[model samples]
Target: MNHRMIDRNREEGHARLYRDYFSDAPTYTETHFRRRFRMRRSLFLRIEEAVTTHDNYFTQRTDVVGVRGLSSLQKVTAALRMLSYGTAGDAVDDYVRIGESTTIESLKRFVKAIVEVYGDEYLRRTNDEDVSRLLRENEQRGFPEMLGSIDCMHWKWKNCQTGWQDRSHLFEDLAESHGPKVRYTVNGYEYNMGYYLADGIYPSRTTFVKTISKPQGKKRKYFAYAQESVRKDVEEHLEFYNLDLQ
Candidate 1:
């Protein structure tokens, strides 16, 4: 093998990589950048500032020969694209000017910075004020004393047991087996607590109000219709809130 030829080939490879993947400005408009990164340019700049301040890994550096390396913008853009689309690191190389290994490192540093900077504000448990506000808002929805609704969903567990486990542990702290201890009256019957609307598969505790499978009397039928309607409204409201947050 010719050593000089091998060296020439290697240098040519590096030149092509720099030209094709890391030469100039990203080939995307602001709108496209927002769509791909899931944030506006202004927001991206703010986040870039935070990330760069928190970790020097995101900051741009000069190469050994005084050439400028990748900027913080390119590294963060690569990382955000990977996260927003759940794509592989190399998938963004063509547009973001990032290699797969560097993209992965950017992702790790970005995540760590986010956790360090915003975790305290966003991850805290609900406090007394939150609970009070929830109770007040829920009372206006016609279900007086109601706290919140609970439901279980089945996820595909590739290696776990297929059978569902009871989630009674969630309510273990509550004194009453039926539900919240707030008392309210309905149809001349006094109840000692608010109840969650659940499916029949849930236990027959007072905390859960399941729909009637066989409604014989007019009262039972009316109750079943009303309960299901209220449940639907709550679910729709929650869906809207989630969309707004996104």
Candidate 2:
């Protein structure tokens, strides 16, 4: 087996990438960066900084033969481009000057580094403060005691269990005798359990609030619309990243 060396000129790619996005006076504006990257420039830079610090593969390094490899910017940009556009790995080669194999490898490492660096805070169980924040936000949106929106991505299986349910540790606290309690009044009726806005497919569980199948009057119709609009948060977030939400 033989390998081809294309001389991607990684240094020039890094220079162009930095000048266009990371330099003090970048060629592109923050708005453009946000539109393409699916996140604010500040957030992207923060992720880049964290990943570079966490993973040495992202840092530019010289080989034993004194040949410098791709800089952190080129590697990160390549990985982000693939994620943001859902494009093929080779699609970023011309700009990022990263080979297809290298682009794929960078993406794998970037994902791993991101998980290792930020997973604890972002992926942990929701605490009291989080529940409180969600309660406040949902209350303003006409959904008192609503925890958050819930949705599922259907997948085929050989023999799956019963219909999907909230099997996470989310409801564990609610079951505890001395756990955090949420109380709210709706239409003169007081409720204790915080619920999530789900779809019709979900079971009629007290913790899962689904919209009306056929909203009758103006009030019901409005409520249905509002609930659905709020429930699509996860879908909207997935779309922003060019991911297949379903």
Candidate 3:
């Protein structure tokens, strides 16, 4: 009874070894590969080359007994599927032909390789050119010298310290806003410049422009419409960027 059980387990483990799921044939075309991996074939191949070149762990090799390991494409595709869909490691076994533990290890190694290779170029600090470009783009959107939008989001920290829980005083500089505070002076009359649009939770600072709850005059209505529209554009851009990454 135990001998048959061991044989069955061994057969099942090798079932995915010869499946042509990752092949470039009619069954699994390049188009299907790109859709599932969320990247073009060329880009995937480029990344594979970079990863295998940078780290020997990702390189395909044969064991002492002549058993061949997974290819670079197989490992990268498994990792990319998990990253794209946030699925369990075992979920990719059928298509990528990689075991759950191996898939998870591939993901860890893939991410490490990406950060090591492209972190500096993509994660560099903004320089003068970047600042100028931001200001110019915002100026075209009726906001001169504006850097970017500012907002806070809450993140749940499971193991947060008690001392870090009640640190509202850290945001003391962002005190509640008062209505119609003068930001800058143009000739004699006061002019508000370099302001950001925020939600009602923020205090009425001259730097922050909140939507008016009730507007009686046409000018106020127009201002509210324009402000909300521009603010929506910023929100939509962020959402688009996130979706593209996913």
Candidate 4:
């Protein structure tokens, strides 16, 4: 069997990629970069630096045949394009000059590297400092002790296995069973719990501050409108909750 050799001029790919996005005078504007990459260029560069430091696979290397491999920028750009656009791995070959198999490998390694490097800070439980910051921010928005707004995404599990249940960890931290006790005041009435703004579908709980479904008076109507407007913040940010229920 003869080996199929295809010349993918990786150096030109790197040069083109740098000129299009990373050069001192890039072809694309910051707005275009953010729209395509789903993040600011600075944030993407920070992530690139972090992932390169954490994993050697992202570092461009010289092969045994004295050929230079793909740059870290090329590998990461291919991976991010797939992730941000939900496009096929082969779709990046023309732009990033990465083969389909290499693109898939880069995605797997890039995701694993990100989780390993940043999961501790980004995926951990909200700490006291986090709570304080949230409280302050929410208070400025007319919610004195609001931790955050609670919302969920619903996706059909096609071909899901039998006897499996959807278990949510969103309420793990706010569960009355093991949740921390705290005190706050609303309208001069002291309460023993912080609350999250939520919709009517959520079960009534001390931790939930759902809007009124039907308002009878002007004051109640205004209150509902104000609560709903502020609640959109969580939906926009796609924030996470780690509370538990009793």
Candidate 5:
């Protein structure tokens, strides 16, 4: 699923990216050199198969070949990049003959259609079996109300229009050479619906745990350090798995 075709458009960009990575640099055979870098085909199908099959296609039935006058591979690559782009469908507009807004709308509809075929998924607490598993992992009291850990994660946003550039922040880039950006959020802590464990910096709610008290003495300091250390351990674990994806 992580494979990608090294088409002409992406070649120039990737070449510049990997310039330092390769010894000889600019001019080289991608098919031969990718083994050195271990770039595999993320996209499973060839351009021909897309044109021929897919009765279950998400879009309104159209003659993709005749109307767009483009190959299936080119179109699929452009579409996938939109998910990573902060500018949404901008690359699609450049790669295909279409309005940017139309491309964005189509991709949104495609994602929804795929997920619907899969399931209506979200962070809400489900049945008790899932609840029990989470509590045992956290060493919390059995039958806690909440789901899992309470934490914020950053999802990287790619290149934005000049005006919006300042709003985005890149996180640790991937080992696959994918750029990193982040969107932070709160997750269920302890249980599917239990209170959050937070520091003075994080906001407090009646449903969550927060440490915002004025420091009265040494006991408070000790407890704060304990929570802080545990939180760091969790983040380190997350970061470890993130590298595994690479």
Candidate 6:
């Protein structure tokens, strides 16, 4: 497909997916810059600031080399090609009319710049809020403690060495499962349900408690006993109830 046409279509598809999976609420004036997710703005600028501050000379070399520092921009273009459309190196050349070596270098530079600059500082660790406050702050359909659901997917990831880290005894897990380059689910298994809920694929969204009844049994044992909020947070959110959510 023509690169222009493909990019246009990809942008449209992303907008559609965002609309479907998430709601776009009216902009709240109360929101501050720090309060908002920085994704909507330029993160590369932040990385550049860090480099210049620490006298990372590579930034200066690549940024101003050959026609006013097209290096960063080139890598960004290359990375976006793969990230947006899953296009390989040759495919990127076909689209951008760039040489294969240039394309490969673009990818390498992009990866190096990204890793060396921004790391896990970009990930959201956790949020600590009581159930009542959580409900009042950001009430969803009904599920309060309920955050998100899961759907099964299969992926053919590249690289065996990196794939070895499976969250178990890293070394032992590596040794235990070694063979025909097979891709397994990240958290595979029924009882492997990370949440407190039983492992079954009612493959659902979420539904909060229907009644305000007291915690009655094992699932509802919270009534008679005041469990530590920390423990509750630590445990899976979907444990209580006979309702096998579908």
**All candidates' TM-scores?**
0.47, 0.64, 0.49, 0.62, 0.35, 0.35
Q: Rank the candidates by lDDT, best first.
A: 4, 2, 1, 3, 5, 6
After TM-score superposition, the amount by which residue 188's alpha carbon in candidate 6 deviates from its true location, in angstroms, is 22
Off by over 4 Å in 3: 1-34, 131-246
Q: Candidate 5 lDDT, tens digit per residue, 1-246?
A: 996533344333333434523335534565543332223232223221332244134233336553322333333434445643334566555434434555565556544443343233321224456445544555553223333333433222232213223422211211122221212234542222343344444333443455536656797876566556655554434222222334
What is the per-residue lDDT of model 6 for residues 127-209, given as tens digits with 9 covering 90 to 100? 33322343332224333333222211121222222452342232223234321122223336222111211113222212211
Q: For residues 195-226, could you state the per-residue lDDT of candidate 3 as single tens digits?
A: 56766665556656677878769988987787
lDDT of 4 by residue, 1-246 (tens): 697866899989999999998999999998888677766677778889889999999999999999999999999999988876668888979878889999999999998897798777575666788778878878898988777886532312221112122222335544432233457876798887668887776665788888988987999999899889988755543332221110
Give the alpha-carbon lDDT of every model.
0.62, 0.73, 0.60, 0.75, 0.39, 0.34
Q: Largest lDDT belongs to which candidate?
A: 4
Measured by C-alpha RMSD in angstroms, how accurate is candidate 4?
Answer: 7.3
Clashes of each: 3, 0, 5, 10, 23, 2
Over 4 Å off, model 2: 141-246
Best by TM-score: 2
- Candidate closer to the true structure by lDDT (higher is better), 3 or 5: 3
Q: Indicate the TM-score of model 1.
A: 0.47
Which pairs of residues collide in candidate 4? 171-243, 171-244, 172-243, 172-244, 173-242, 173-243, 173-244, 174-243, 174-244, 175-244
Better of 4 and 6 by lDDT: 4
Q: Ten consecutive residues with minimal summed lDDT in candidate 3?
A: 153-162
